[model samples]
Target: MVEKSKELKEKEQKILSNKTQSIYALALLIGFCIVINIIFSFVNFKIDLTEEKRFTLTPSTVQMLNGLKDNIYVEVLLEGQFPAGFKRLQESTKDLLDQFRSESPYVQYRFFDPLALVTVAEKNNRIKDLAEDGIKPTNLRVMEENESTEKIIYPVAVVKFGSKSIPVNLLENSIAGFSDEEVLNQSINLLEYKIADAINKILRVQKPTIAITKGHGESKPIETQDLINTLSPFYNLKWISLDSMYTVPDDIKLIIMPNPSVKFDEKAKFVLDQFVMKGGDVMFLINRLKIDMDSLRNVRAEYVPIENDVNLEDMFFKYGVRIQPNLILDLECSKIPLVVGKLGTGAQTELFKWYYAPLLSSNSINPIVKNIDRVNAYWTSTVDTIKTKTDIKKTVLLSSSQYSRVQFAPVRINFEILRYDPDPSKFNKPNQPVAVLLEGKFPSLYENRVSPDMLKTLTDIKAEYKSSGDEAKILVVSYGKLINNLYNPTQSDYMPMGYNTFEKQLYGNKDFVINAIEYMFDEKGILAARAKEVKLRLLDTVKIKNERSFWQFINVLLPISLLGLGALFFNILRKRKFAS
Candidate 1:
């Protein structure tokens, strides 16, 4: 009996010892967790497993975030009930903002649905307020009970840093024949660009000034209004004439010479040369072969190519590039509505490849056009980079596809060719450069041609004629219509640049122009963020539909079955322990 008592006492002591050790171990675990939390609070670490690195921020974005000096308040208007596509967009926006917040403590954001109200009157008033604040609403087709209804929702956000605020469009709908899924995917892809641009705008201290050279047969203001609107938010746009001014304005940093139908006078050319000599950027969107499309209005669709007498070839050659006097015909072209036959008091029109309109591809990995799709070009000429005396760095930003041919000047533009299949043998030219960026100290065209007196009259009295210029940037394109928008008379409004009404698609014109300007001024690599691509991984509809029932059954009942079995096993073990 004494031995049994001793054994019971020892068992109790062992149980007490185990309880003490467990308590000590729990305390140590809590202390360890606290230490880890403290360490992590001072570290910035993340892992992105997405194939396209969608969750990984670009180095430019990271730099921008790290350099923030003020707090940014973002109010996203993509809230309330939305379809799966929109929900995905919302989640993406949230994830992006969360990343920003993690990187910098100054970034804050919230989601608010402008239409989330109890009454129609309240919603209408809210919409009016939003519109007044420059937040436009988009129509979304919401699926209801056995029906789909159109609802207006604001897919916009307002970013405020200090006293400045800029609106960001969350929806990137191309005026093209893209499905809802594709449009949503594009919007997701462009989220970073829109947000980063808004931030860049708000953070800018002073807006740069750019001159759109007029009085040289350039496109009218109405034709270029869309481009103006896009750049007005970031730059101070001015309509300047080289005919009147002896010298370029001091504030004007960039000069855009649009498609000029008239020739550039010697005086104007001298002024442009001096401007470049003084380190000014210039974009020459010119064409050598001017094919008049308006002639098609004359019952039978036909036109002829006329060589434009702009007379700037000599100046361009001095700048290390040449806009050839030829038109590019590409098999990979945009479709145009052509009349095949006549209907009752009408014409039966069908889509045909307009060989004159080359869908120029952006094959360059340059930051300006990297990852950007094809830019719509009409009657574009070939831009050839030639050997020049200056050490110019010429980067080709745009080119035609492999199936392209260059038709030299004085060639007839027959619309009848649209009816017949193009002979592949004729289109032997491959990857013809259409647009190029030149950066270097360019040799002046008026190096020896202009006398001291003539140069003095054109430039500042204190300015000496420079035979060679400082390092400058010049973008030469063989086409000019890239920035022009189509005007709808019925609506009395202008469509977006690069928008094709027939295809309901948006081209890369707007993006290309914006990126061009951005790169020209991007000292901090902010514009490089546009090149970030997020891969789209969509579930196969066929597979989903086929396995729908099985997934539904597993999702609904599997967890409950497992829980019931676990509870039954636990109950049996408890009973056995008590019975023992």
Candidate 2:
């Protein structure tokens, strides 16, 4: 009886000892966790395990966030049920916004479902209101249990700062020739840029002045309405007639000369030179040749291409680029509707490849054109970089594709050419540059050519005639119609720039122009965010389909089997321990 009592006391002591050890371990773990939490609370940082480091924001973005003076509110409309791809986008957006909030107290965001818990009439009214606010809805076909249902979603965000607000399209639908998943990945890559840019525009205190040169047969306000609308939020735009003004206004930091038809006089050229000398940037959208599509109103109509005598040749050569009076014909071109046959009283029309309107693309990874869609160019000319004495960094931003050929001026353009297919053998020329970006100090066009009277006028105006310009940037595009928006008579409104009505496609013209101006004006590296790339990691559907059953079986049985074996081992161990 004493031996049994001693054994019972021994077992009780062992149980008490095990309980004490477990309590100590629990206390230590809790203390360690508290210390870790305390340290992390003071030092906030995240560990991005992604191979691409996609979650890491660019330094420019961080700097912009740090300099925020006012609160930025973002209302993301991409809420509620979605496919796996869209859900990934939604999660990424939340993660990015959380990171933004962590960096700055001024950043705030919320997710909202416009149609959630609403009646049919209310949902329709909500969608209409969103549309009026420029937040268009995207129709999605969702698959559920082998049945497909249509779902409408608003994949956009409204960013507001103070009284100003702008809608940001979260999905990049302009990308072509990419899979849906890849497009979504690209859209995710651009979210930071789009959101940050909108916020920057809204919070901008001081805006630079941009002058649109008039009296040079440039595009009218109606033609370039979209461009003006796009830039008005960021810059102060004014029409400056070169013929009337003695010189470009002192406040004008940039000059956009759009498609000047008439030749520029020597006096006008002098003003432009002095403007460049004063460290002002310039974007010259020059068309060396004229090919009017309006002249081709009837079937088999023709128009002869002629040299547009804008007379900026010497100026361009001095600036390190020469726009040749030739037209680029590319195999990769946009289609135009043509009368193919007569259908009773009405004319039957068919879409034909219009080689003259070359769809311009860039292989260079320049920030202005990187990851952007093709720029639509009408009667584009070729640009060649001249070997100049000044150290000018000339970068080609847009070029024709591999199957392209250039026709010199006076080439006949007719509807008859569209009837026959273009021969590939003839289109041997490739990568002909259509746009060139020059960055350096430029010599004045009127350095020695300026008359004494002009020099006196410059001196009288208190404008120093600088023989060589200060460091500046000049973007020369051979196609002038790049910024022109089509006017629809029936709608009585101008179409958006880069929009093709027939093809229902939006080109990169608007983005390209904006990016070019932004690149020139960007003192900070904020525009660099546009070049961010997120790698696409997609599952192999074929492999999953083949091994679905195998994986399912292993996933179901492995855990149960392990649990059963563990229980059996524990029972054996317990029995052995008690077996005295």
Give the number of the best model, judged by TM-score. Answer: 2
RMSD of each: 4.3, 3.3
Point out the worst 10-residue segment of candidate 1 by lDDT: 295-304
- Residue pairs in clash, model 2: none
Number of the predicted model whose lDDT against the real structure is largest: 2
Q: Which stretches of candidate 1 lie over 4 Å from their true place?
A: 1-12, 49-52, 132-134, 175-179, 296-304, 337-351, 370-373, 447-450, 454-460, 488-492, 501-504, 539-580
Q: Quantify all predictions' global Cα lDDT against the true fold.
A: 0.85, 0.88
User: On residues 20-111, what C-alpha lDDT tens digit does candidate 1 reach at each position?
Assistant: 99999999999999999999889977788877888887887888888897799999988888888888889989988998889889999999
lDDT of 1 at 376: 88
| Model 2 deviation from native, Cα RMSD in Å | 3.3
